[model samples]
Target: MPVPVVSVAQMRQWEQASWSAGRTEAAVIARVGACLAAWLRRHVPHNDRILILAGKGHNGDDARAALPHLQGRAVDLVEVRDPETALPDLERALARGPDWILDGLFGIGLNRPLAEPWCRLIERINQARSRIVSVDVPSGLDADTGRPWGATLRATCTLTLAAPKQGLLHPAAHTFTGRLEVIPDIGLVPCPIQSELCWTLPEDFLDWPPPRPVAAHKGTFGHLAIVAGSTGYHGAAVLAARAAQRARPGLITLITPASVYAVVASQLQAVMVHPWSAAHPLPGRYTALLFGPGLAAADLPAEIPATLARLWQEANVPIVVDASALDHVPRGPIPRDALRVLTPHPGEAARLLGTTTNEVQSNRVAAVRALSGQFGGAWIVLKGYQTLIGRQHGPIFVNPSGNPDLAQGGSGDVLAGYLAGLCAQPPLQGDPERLIRYAVWQHGAAADALSRRHPAWVVEDLVRTLGRVAPHRVASTARPATPTTPP
Candidate 1:
């Protein structure tokens, strides 16, 4: 299913277009209301009392419209009004007993913090035992950014209108929204509008890396080189190499300080190691290279640019710069036409872009694009709750998988390694853009798999989990001389 995520402003424009084309709001609402009633009847059954917390908005109208069709079932309506007009049915529901609450108090257009009466009522609704269901977005959530305005109602489910709102999947909005479902108001006008909630599932990355031939050799999978770890951070390097190996790379190379090479080598049986020193230069045959992840920030100014330049000049390898490596290169005009990928958290992204974390969070699409463009159109993965993937154009995707349990150290290292391995595959080629898109989807999928079976997920687990997780498989046996366009 194509998950169309749109903003409040776009939704309004779509509705206006529909209205201009002669479709009435009441008619659209009636058809949607009937669907809601049918779904409610199937899910909640008859005789169950439903308490709808209705605001003065159209969302309120949607809840009110459903009341008549409920038929003989007990309905409790809580009207939140200022200069009150009378809706007798609403009055009856307000006076009724414990029931399921439908929170239609506010839509995504609400920019200000919630005011009195409504705030108090939200508190009451929270305390009630009834399961709360939001109509569009949870009232207090900022439609564009997912931050709560003041207090927001926690809903068991949110029946969002037309399409999924970007705010619903925001990390900050997790408290309010539950399982989000989009119901298309199909009778309404269809505008040529794109939604903000663009996400990729395991199925979406199907064409990536292609498949291997039966007679493939070790070098066929692609040679992966990882430059990571200091004395204390060997775990970071180990996790990255292991993750790459798990992703089925043909060969693996680890470049690190001499102090920890033996330990890293022993810990990782499959990956080869090279000591990172002034004496040794990186090999020219590597298919992909991953730098950073425990690299000392103090050494970045001298070594990073030199290393990046060498990687670019020596081999046409797709490179991934992550963790401390981002410190190596700050946000500025980068050399053109390089195969690079940058994975940064909001704080790191802010530092690179010369802005505050707040600025990065405010408009993630802009930040992602800026970083990508400044650095030769490198793939940018802005890691957060709704991880935004960037291209030179804008945010190409916002991943909605994984869980809070994944909030641990070394996860980024695992991701860096995951991308490196994917880059090495024969089918994936040296396309940094495609690598970022597919790697992020697979990384989140692995985390999602881990979360289902356990608690307190670790990054090392991600390294081990990759082989168990399947990549999208296609039937074409011929390794096309040219890159296949993403389906």
Candidate 2:
């Protein structure tokens, strides 16, 4: 299930509401402090020296309150205001060389740039070799945009209170915030937002395929059709088909240019290869259609649009658009009955929106939202650092599982094929949104798993590692209900 993500303003509203409902500011502060203290005890060793940097705000109050809970540690508290006056004590604490520095300088509501004293203090903190643990958000980061103000504190771990801030999920926030954890018992409630940004977790895969009943057979899982590849890019088709097969799709049919059919066919034994031509029609019984990978616009026939439209209207199945196929997407609003997903990199997204890649990367949230609206209601998977999955009416989900290792050729093809294969499964065929999300998560998870074993892994390694992370556990009869957003 997806977790809720809120802005600083929305978080303030929730805090205000909590206060209005009789939860005092001190109580909230104490609750947050206690949670932070508990986490520190569990993760940090008792023998390690601790330095708590408190500033003037509720964040300071939270830090002050947490001091009592960390009784056993050799702790030093510095209430910083003017850097000139606080420097001596701060230097003294630093000279002691604490293992951890708890930064409670600013919370989520900081909008303005940091002044002289705070800037100096943040710089000193960053210069230190100690591991910094930030409370709520990093000191100089914009909780809304994920942009740093002046000298931002790069925290080793950020223990965010309640829900995750929107900025924390941004691509730029990765280095500033290393390992992010949410403390749910900090008296914070969900804000009234239609869509949220959520972190994808491993447990979310519990019911991926659900339990395969004893009566299930090869035909029960459903079939996938992949329309991809060209003369020079036959590897894309092979990678996509191989990935789809790894996802345990019941059957997979590859529709590629006749020039590359033999090459693609030689690479896979499980996938049925078909040489595509104007005379050969697509399979009518496919559960989903994954269009694009290495297919170029020049390689397509003049009736490509009509052929895609006919298949969409006739089959009424999920369609995943990716790679060069994205160049040929219809300009008008998408069909109301069609379940479509567009997987585009920044460049492809820019091409689709008639904008620059720089513009799209600068504001990913707005770009994806605009793309979703442009399609009337298609799911847009904007691929990048923090890959965003957005639906017309649903919240944008940030995939947190992938790493820089996925920044290689054929990764997108694998992702597209994996999504299509998941959609082809019996339990996920009807729930295209969930299937897409799961595929994105699994794709990243596989890469993450491979990254640990090998410093660098190729596309083929990722395809092979998919089975390791694929859910084989049979969920109990009374499985947790799939989480839903409030209407």
In angstroms, give how far residue 375 of model 1 lies from its true place: 2.4
Give per-residue CA lDDT, model 2, range 383-485, as digits (tens): 9876888865667777666778899999999999888888777666666666777788788778877876787789989888775675322111111122111
Best by TM-score: 2
TM-score to true structure, per model: 0.72, 0.81
Query: What are the candidates' C-alpha RMSDs?
Result: 8.2, 5.9
| Cα deviation of 259, candidate 2, in Å | 2.6
- The C-alpha stretches of model 2 lying farther than 4 A from their native spots are 19-82, 92-102, 129-131, 145-149, 167-209, 297-306, 333-335, 452-454, 467-487
Residue 280 Cα positional deviation in candidate 1, in Å, after optimal superposition: 4.7
State the displacement of the C-alpha of residue 4, model 2, in Å, after optimal TM-score superposition: 3.6
Against the reference, the lDDT scores of all candidates come to 0.71, 0.78
Cα deviation at 399, candidate 2, in Å, is: 3.1
